[model samples]
Target: MPLARTSDLLAAAVADRRGLPAFNVITLEHAEAIAAGAETADTPVILQISQNAVGFHGGRLLPLARACAEVAAAARVAVSLHLDHVEDADLLRAAPGAGFSSAMFDASHLPHDENVKATAEAAAWAHRHGLYLEAELGRVGGKDGEAPLSAHAPGARTDPAEAAGYVADTGVDALAVAVGSSHAMTTRTAALDHGLIGRLAAAVPVPLVLHGSSGVPDAELRGAVAAGMVKINIGTALNLAFTPAVRAHLAENPAVTDPRKYLDPARTAMAQTVAHLARVVAGGGQG
Candidate 1:
């Protein structure tokens, strides 16, 4: 199958009032596992390649992006390629040729005026190249060695009205809002502001995205979808599953020398996580 359109997947999820799970890919194993899991669950998924992942891959996007595209093409389920958390204009420009159906131009780290200016230009370019664009407004916590935001922090949460204005101003296809969850949290104890999500859903014209969703619990994830979070970005949870599997495999067989020996179990573990999360996002959490 060819790559599924991100716009179509998002539109379908929106119509069903469900959340779409997007997993970040750091390696070929990650892409393979995500595709396998999505196929196993028979759910549509977005395979995201973040800027950091590109940096890890010697600053080349096409090698990994094309690999993911091939993985998506071979998958039985609907799979879309996405450029995640992209701050580089050159990278965003390369997205179309790299087989990305959508891209998130992250300017949230910049001041509001600068964010708007940068994101608007990116959005326009994305539109010209026929890519669906997702943008962040407020700062989601725990990115780039930053401290996690307490629930009471004023800047931790996105203002509904401000988000709506930002969406309108930037002409983005979707809005990633900071509700309560923080990025890279290993524990699943992050409490989401469901009420704020609902308000943002109502206020913003575009689909609402929840970044740092790996920290959100199962029930909270379902609640977020119900409260109108359309896109759920998950990264750490896959690593949580992958890394432990690799360690456990090595512990059981310390003599193993081949990377494939451990990576196989690691991939399988991550696949199971993906399948379970797919069910959860599809409103069938218990299975």
Candidate 2:
């Protein structure tokens, strides 16, 4: 299949009451690896590129976006190409031109009305290009570099009432709510409020997205999905899986400095993580 729209992928996940796994793509390897994982799981998945990741590579979104689109197109299962946690309006606007099918315009650092107005502009731009837009409400605590951080607990929580208003104002296809999951947690111990998840899901008109999910344990991840988290965004877990493998490979073979050997194993490890999460989010355990 070709690249998928976020609304299409998320609607399927919501209708089936399953969580859609949206993994961050930091490199071509990451994109290919996640694609392989979805192929293994036989389910639809999303490949996301955060603004931080784009900055890491010197702001070349076009090359990576095209590569991710290729990986999604080649995957056996459906794949959606998404830009995640983008706070910069210019950067968010660039995604549709770069061939992204979906995006999250994150303006959570701004005050409520500004966040809504900024995100609405982004949503309108995306909608104009036939791209699906996801918006953030209430700052989710944590940092994927510049992602607005909150001092409050990861589960410090967003008011579902305010969340609904944000959605209505922005007309976003999906909403990422703050219900206590923080970003870049490698410990998998971050707490999530299932009650908040349910409340936000019922209150918002669009699908509910869970950011900072990499910190949430597998069991808790399952519970979050069951609680109405339709789109679960993960990045740290894949980084954890791949980084040590790459380091070990480089350490062992100092003489053999070809990038492929190390990169290949790291890619495989990330693919495995994706497969693991996909199965959980797809609600296929005990099968």
Candidate 3:
């Protein structure tokens, strides 16, 4: 099948009260591994490329985007490409053309009114291009680089009423809310406020998205879906699986100068992790 749209995947998940796993892809291997995992689990998944990832690719996006689209197209299960946490207006505007079916135009760092205005403008552009737009209402708790996380104050949770109004005002297809999970967390110990999640789901018109979901435990993630989170974005967990595999392979075989020898094992590890996460997101046990 061709690449699926983010809206379509989320819509199905919402109807079934299931969570769609959205994995952040940093390399071609990541994209292939994620797609392989989704195929293994027989579940639909989202392949996300973050703005930070674009920077890592030398300020280029299309090359990786096209690769992800190819992966999605070849996958047995439905797969979509998403541009995640895109703050720059130009980058947001360019996403759909670069093969992203959806984009998150992050203006949550701006003042409320300014955020609304900026998100509305970006949403309009995305809609005009028939793309799904996701907007954040509050700081989703994590800085991109060495930037101080304190710059955005931790624990800034989203207000349900304000979230509804923001979604209404911006015409966004989804909302990424701050519900206690912090970005780039290496430990799966983040305690999400389930009550807040249910309230946000009731109040917000669109589907709710959970960013920094890699911090939340697997059981809690499943509970989050039952509480009405339709889209769960994960990053660090895949990295956690991938990096160790590469390290182990290199340590065991010092003579292995071939990149594929090490990278293949890393990709396999990532694929297994993705498959388990996919099952978890689908409300299945870690199979």
Candidate 4:
């Protein structure tokens, strides 16, 4: 199968009022497992590679991106490749050429005006290269153990009016709004603002995305989707499944020096998690 267009998948999900799961790819096994999971669930999925993950792999994007593309192409289900949290212009430009259908140009760390300016430029360049662009607003926090916003922090949640204006100014295809979910949360206890999600959905012109969704509980995810979240980005949950399995494998078999022996179980665990989450997202938490 060829790589599916991110826009097409998103459009279909939007029409169906379902959430599309976009899982992060940190390693080749992650890509393989995601594809396998989507295949198992008989649904389309997006495999995303973030800038920080590229940094972890020696600042190279093509190697992993191509690997993900190849894995997606071989999968039984429709799978798209996306570059996530891309702040570097060079890396952003590299996406389309490296087999990505879409890219998230992150400028959320900047002030509103600056974020609009930078994201607008990136979106223009991405459009020119035939890539669907995603941008973030209201600065969802807590990446790599950074402190997340308090419940009452100023500008912590996305204002519908501001988000609409930002999307209009930036010309992004999708918007990741801050609605109380934080990135890299190990516990699935994060509460989403469903009313705010509905408001943002009604206000924004394009599809809505939920980042830091790994922290969100199943019922909260269903509520978010029902409220209008189309794209759900999940990363930490895969890590949570993978790392513990590897640790347990090592604990049980102390002399197992073969990487395959441990990595097999880790990949299996991630695949199971992806399958379940895909069902949960597609079925609106009915999984």
Error of 4 at 136 (Å): 0.5
Regions more than 4 Å wrong, model 2: 139-155
Per-residue alpha-carbon lDDT of model 4 for 161-272, expressed as tens digits?
Answer: 9788888999999998888888889999888889999999999989998888888888898889999999999999999999999999999999999999999999999999
Candidate 3 collision pairs: none
Cα lDDT tens digits, model 2, 134-227, are: 8777553344543543322353468788788878888899888788888888888877888988988889888888888888888888999998
What tens-digit string does per-residue lDDT give for candidate 1 at 1-287? 88999999999999998889999999999999999988888889999999999999999999999999999999999999999989899999999999998999988766677788999999998999999999887743345756433222334888798888888899999988888888888999988989999999999989988888888899999999999999898999999999999999999999999999999999999999999998899775573
Q: What would the TM-scores of all predictions be?
A: 0.94, 0.92, 0.94, 0.94
Name the lDDT of candidate 2. Answer: 0.83
Pairs in clash, predicted candidate 1: none
After aligning candidate 4 to the native by TM-score, how far in Å is the CA of 27 from where it should be? 0.4
Candidate 1 lDDT for residue 234: 92
Tens digits of per-residue lDDT, candidate 3, 117-163, equal 99899988898999899888764233453221211134767878878
* Candidate 3 whole-model C-alpha lDDT, 0 to 1: 0.87
